[model samples]
Target: MNPLTAIRMEALLSGRSDQLGPDVAERLSNHPLDSIDTEFPHYARSVDSPDGIERPTERHPVFFGCYDWHSSVHSHWALIRQLRLFDEHPARSDIVDRIDDRFTAENIAREVEHFEDNETFEKPYGWAWFLHLVSELCLWEDDRAAAWRSILKPLEETIVTLIKSEFLPQKRPFRVGTHQNSAFALHCILDYARTLSNERLESAVTDTATAFYAEDRNYPVEYEPLGWDFLSPSLTEADLMRRVYSRNEFTMWIEQFLPDVTTAPYDTILEPVHTNPNRDEGVALHLVGLNLSKAWCLAGLASTLKDHQYVEAFERSAKQHMECGLDRAFTDEYAGSHWLSSFVLYLLTRNEGGIAPE
Candidate 1:
């Protein structure tokens, strides 16, 4: 059996989400650098289930090139470092090493041998996500400077070449419904450029960021946590709301900056928003809001907006929304139940005299 597939198959059988989170964390601590060099081989072969039969498969003879879970793979490295739970179970490094062996340059180049240059929507598939994974890996582990250089140095040039050759002059907007992917790509470039101090990549990222933010106002676009691929463009506003993470982020971005107000005619309003219907949604919203609102407000108060009025306004906004944004997020079954309200319950339990903004 192919090595990466074999390992993944084993992991799947090992009680994934519930049981393996800690196991994975533990293994990472002991083997931080053990399997750093392994990579999964690209495959084109196929096998029928249980019965011997022919089946279609990826272009590569081993693992599908397009199936590269680069982000998830690299994320393993970061997770090991951050949680420190991997110290007890160091044997798990073998799994990580198996894949890194196949994730090398020669492997990737072979995988992209016939990649098309003119396809307008290159899917971006998993490349940017992997780059972010690499960044997280380097940041958390430290002393992985060589790994960072090995992965990012060549990758940046490849991405920049694509941007200059294919993306720069396209008068038409990108494939509709790909705002998040565009944002992720721009972020990868910007982040790596900032990390490595690469001026060329920085300039390219600036242009891409400007273009992406410009497109924000036209249609409903967001980075939903669970959806796969790009979602369909024609989803109604209500359905879109059901999938969007929070109205809070929308409000935050819209309040200060009108990035792409012209390109997105529908989003011209100052506070376009959405809410998830799951009971857990409200809790998640409050968690995100409190963390970010306090941080942003504190920074603003400390640096630029030191006035009493600005401070009061900021505090009032945070306090008001700390509990109000949940109305649409929570289900009717739990709507009136205060105990179920994450923000309200948190405020009640903490019971600290609140800041008066200034």
Candidate 2:
């Protein structure tokens, strides 16, 4: 039998679905390894002048694969996360080699140059995931991780500078359920800030999150899971607020934001989304990610609202979304396979234990 198949069988027998054991690590690692270096069929999302259009590999030497820039960044994070969680896995050395090859200082310098030229490029989403990747490397104790972190420091600083200068100053938050969602970006930035003990960035994110969403009440959960949405605007906002507010403060804030938390529209938000199999691959597959992202947000909310009346319902919906998401996360179609594993890994590890504040 295939080794991975055997591992999955063992996990099934042992009832280890929720555990981040070697079996799960092995399964999740395959997605990144499969697409991280596959450069074709790429979505550059780049701006070019008449001088020339450059290939994605040239434009983004370090993060030019896995369909698009953000997906590639998070896929790298997923690989590093797998390595951190299961050091003894058979693919550890291969994972290390791949990271080592891609994380060269020169490559990162080129990536930095691209971002510098295109100031608004991948503003929050891609930038958020890049910092997340850096956070993972920063926390890992391995010498290799330290080396990569040092190499990545320049780009990391560039992104932080951009976030503070460009994004935080906006008077209003983008409350959409897509990549532009301000709440989701703040969620990621806050976690990265706290992980590295960067007080300046932390304060900036706290202030911005509070200003953008602290006054929110009666969130329109009914309008969620918008056509191609992978992130829930309401849930992501609540999750980010959980990190910013104290437990007591968050308790009150959530009660107001998601009032009547267990009924109609809220219940509708909890229900896992299903995509019509016949729909276009790019559009429909987002629902798969929507399920995983919802699971992540709901799980974070449940963790913070442990004593709330709706906690049990949140937990139940989170599980349902997780199962529904995991069922389709490992697809062969490039549309889903290129990026969904990162969402799977993120949800499985609860954003690598960065859900709540220290």
Candidate 3:
């Protein structure tokens, strides 16, 4: 499914499956796409980097500050992924109209101009990703294809340099940290490679994925000989009646430690065996509901196209989220982020085309 269609589905569903309908989709197609500013209100009052704004400047919508490459990577992946899904989905016309009005280069330039008046340079990654988004939007409209082709190369080259200097060699026992979050980088690399059709870039991405997988596999051994154990959470007695965690881990945990939380196996918490000695003692909960929901959606999309490898990847990805549980990563709400929601809808609804016969 196209990105806009996916986003439209997400908007329709919000928190309930019943809300999704053909009429709703039709109505949204006519609605103009709102920029990040409308969705995230804090942007208007958001501050820039310490050195970015002059004393007289007022805060703009901050996107929480564009200085961090990590955020940029996520933004890039989300935009590209959504766009790809949008272009390919059956509901293309609807999304095309909405995004055409909102995400155009001129619109992006206007936003940037507003920020520029404050003399705040978005982080390098932010600039790179936003440019890419604009270029893709141009491609969608077929209005500035030549310009995009000319500009994309330099932006990508800059990103490549950033990766080599700041992202290479990979980190050990990849936990959430500043540079350790190279998954977003991998996503960006893949998007750029797909865009530019560079085999060399593709190879780089594969190699990085392999290394990251190896780390996940050998997480325990990589840490101290004692192991890469994670900490677990302590539940309050008052909260016992509430759903403790999803069914996935609940079953696994209860099998070894008693009591199934529910009927369907829900997402669970995971820890590297070697280092996880402390996991049970820590209070970090998993963000399973949010994570698995997206994973399922991604897997569903891949499965619809009969891409076995991608399907596997989506399933594995979903499993990771289930293992992570809701509290640990996606506790903001059952809904999580809008991008994730839209991605899932795209995954779930994209022309089922056909599921290979089992």
True-structure RMSD for candidate 2: 3.2
lDDT of each: 0.35, 0.82, 0.34
Best by lDDT: 2
lDDT of 2 by residue, 201-318 (tens): 8999999999999889988898877778888888889888989999899999988898586786567988998766566577588889998888878877887788789788887888
CA RMSD, predictions in order = 14.3, 3.2, 12.8
TM-score of 1: 0.42
Which structure is stronger by TM-score: 1 or 2? Answer: 2
Which rank order by lDDT, best down to worst? 2, 1, 3
lDDT of 3 by residue, 1-358 (tens): 2223333323332222234444333322221122222333222345656666532112322232222322322343333334443444334554445334443444344444454453224333354344345334433435433444343444435545555444545563233312223443354345445555567755665565555442222122122112211111111100110112233433233233312212212212212111122343222212222243333333333334343333354345434433333223212222223222322332243232111111
Off by over 4 Å in 3: 1-32, 43-157, 169-173, 177-180, 215-289, 292-294, 297-340, 349-358
> lDDT by residue for model 1 over 1-358, one digit each (tens)?
1111223322322222333344333432222232232223222234447665422122222123222333233334343323222334444455345445544666545434423432333335244434444444444343443564364445434645666666544444343333333443444445545545667766665665455453344344332222322222222111112112134442443334323323345222212123444544423433332332232222222223334233444344333333333333222322112112222212221211111111
